[model samples]
Target: MDLDVFVAAHRAEWERLDQLLRRRRHLTGAETDELVTLYQRTATHLSQVQASAPDPALTSRLTTLVARARSAVVGARKSTWRDAAHFFTAGFPAACYRTRYWWVPTGIVFTLLVAVIGWWIAGNPEVQGAIAAPEEVREMTREGGAYETYYTESPAAAFSAQVWTNNAQVAAISLAFGALLGIPVVWVLLMNAVNVGVGVGLMAAAGRLDVFMGLILPHGLLELTAVFVAAGVGLRLGWTVIDPGRRTRRAALAQEGRAAIGMAIGLAAVLFVSGLIEGFVTPSGLPTWGRITIGIVAEAAFLVYVFVVGRRAYLAGETGDIVEADRAAEAPVAA
Candidate 1:
């Protein structure tokens, strides 16, 4: 109730708290402890002042001091634009580069499967008939037909968003379900390969393989790569469940799972870029070579980013996991 006496009693403590806050980044352990204690006391004082004396200026000063001390004690872990930048530049690429062994082979295998399927379907009338009536197949593969018009069917912006959402979902599923022994991921990749193969087969049989290549390559190169990345990461996650090496299974899964989640986010952006190309460039008036060139450039840039930027970051000890300060504390285990 005696405001003057209270101010005199706590003035030194308030100043000390302020000083510690000003030097928070350089605080010794003892000083950090002192700051926490002072913060608690100052918060209590502010509460008492508000409920009792209600001194305008003193209450205001204590409120500000207490707020600063709370930040110092509790820390500000809110992510900012800087975190996003680091993830794209270092975390995402590092993850892709680190897991290249899994995904690179996945892409190769998937491509080969697609090619074999296409060859089988294009060469065999029975296989072609099994897919659809010959007439329907012919219609779909005809010039300016279903395959060519599919990209232009919707408004470009709407199509882009739709494509992005669909691809992002596929990528998310691949990454999220990897823990289920990666069976789902394999199935996903198979289904995608079949779909692409059907297109290739139909177009090749119709003597319009060029049309299919032109339409698909503009976005397929990057889009398929993203899917492969997700599938590979998912498979790795499944394998981690089987053989955790030096780490406990739980620890290894937790670490890889975090990186997979980050990859999901980063891959969403990658798919978005491909969606833009698919929606706009693929369907635009650009020459086929021009569209294909754009797609190749985008894919190449992504590879370079992974190998150059990502490799550098990984070598510098980045693991695509959350920074140590943000990671959950684990109980120490004997090696």
Candidate 2:
């Protein structure tokens, strides 16, 4: 076909592609193929026109087509409110629990965080030196660091606030960092574990272990558990590249990750509930017996969920199970 004739014939179709892509999704393969052909055809024509044709009219037409193509891509992106919510709720925790033996690695990371934090507080000369100072010196200053500052005041409020903030942070971090699927997720989970280990350890070493445990255990267990769930999502993403067992890395991660959706939302809900308890019920200086009871109850609930309820809730079942996983996995990529 003549260059000008082909360019003119495609002008209207390119504009239609841009408009149609912007307005709706789920385009049939034939329709999409047509759009792709229109784009490629226009691009080739523009290149030929630039190199050989000197017609002013053809140049203007090519410029217009280029704009339309860029616009079409923007129109193609699928950033809906539902996708984002689904990404957090369905994308993180479920993947974490589903990926085989996820907890084992998470536990190791958590323990290391705890030990590092504990050592920093108990042994390092700077910390030990401060703790050993006379009571009068302690009394004179109000500028305690994060750990110490929380120690002296209304621990209930501090602990409660920490639960809410940390839990939310874990969810956000998991979803955002899952894109790369590496240390960011691991580090986030490890950081939480370290915080928990050190925070609890300091209380014990200072002889306020009972008070700290009582205050923290009421909600900390739930909150931390949720955080681990988020980390699992990231782990799922990373394993796609690292292990990729069988069907290409992309294909495997996509499948396993898809199956993990429910758990992510469930974890977010757990974080929310944990925040509520920490805010309303847990308080610093609660009696030892009371703290123990709270810890026992919280731990019991977590165990129950992990062993019994979690299995049922996190797993796909009945109806839409396999189909839904495929849809969730493809939805983002399709966009």
Candidate 3:
């Protein structure tokens, strides 16, 4: 089992495998067969060397050759525009449709929480005082005040980009940290709920509920929905950790995590549209009803995308995960 002897013996085969791999796309039928045969032989050589001589340099060379030959033999999946299209049209929406129960309930509970907080603040003088000084509250709720001017303070395009980046980060955080049992996701959602509640409460107390509605509804509808989707997916990830069902915890987490990543990408696009609405339509001179109508339409379209397009995709077996070919191979386990 002399290392040099082993290397010298297998060196020609390894080099041939490398050459075939380099021209893998143009290989003839016989060359392809040779490549597969060389790959198998090289893999065997690698195993023998590791077991017998264990020379680092020879092991490394054979490992690289075997890997390249394996790739040439098996073929690799490349990302294309079609892949992107499939993700948006089928993967993302189907994921949303599949997990609607989690997110739909999340949306409902979050809305109720915001409403309750707003109601408490509007009704209780103590709560109002605790939130801000009387004059500060007045400034925020007053016509043409801080609440309305915030959208217009920066250029529309810049504002929209900034908003999109911020929301995307939040969504990413929610999805990424979901494996931590969803604590961070809940915290993120709570913080948002509080902010919205404060705005709603102050405006309602000032009898400017209509003004608040006009300002928020245009973008809030879609914007909040995206957030809800992220949170729901995140919670689902956490729940997967708790109860992996028929699958092992590792397998369940891996599947849900990949789907969550896809959801994050899709939600970013969703947030971008809402950011545009918030920056332009929310601050534009359009009538309140018009702005709100535009928001409603955007939201309705998203719902239809989820329920109609997403449902069909889900029913057809899209789980918002990558294709099987792209997924990592899992080890077999006992039942």
lDDT of 1 by residue, 1-335 (tens): 89999999999999999999998999889998898888878887886776568789997898788767766776878999999999999999999999999999999999999999999999998999999998898789998789988999999999999999999999999999999999999999999999999999889999999989999998999999999999999999999999988766767899999999999999999999999999999999999999999999999999999999999999999999999866533434457
Worst 10-residue lDDT window for candidate 2 reads 326-335
Q: Report the Cα lDDT for residue 226, model 1.
A: 97
Q: How close is candidate 1 to the true structure, as a TM-score?
A: 0.79
Stronger candidate by lDDT (2 vs 3): 3
For residue 173, what is the lDDT in candidate 3?
92
**Which should have the higher TM-score, number 2 or number 3?**
3
What is the alpha-carbon lDDT for the whole of candidate 1? 0.92
In candidate 3, residue 232 scores what lDDT?
93
Residue 49, candidate 2: Cα error in Å is 29
lDDT digits (tens) for residues 1-335 of candidate 2: 37658657766876776665565367777877776666666665665565456478877866676556645543544558976554444443334435426654675667677767765775553664555453533332223434444434555566566766767777767745665766788777766665576555555555565555555666666666666656765676676767665554445655655544455555666777777666655544566567557756775776564545434546743211243322311211221
Clashes of each: 0, 6, 0
What's the true lDDT of residue 95 in model 3?
Answer: 97
Candidate 1 lowest-lDDT run of ten: 325-334
Ranking by lDDT: 1, 3, 2
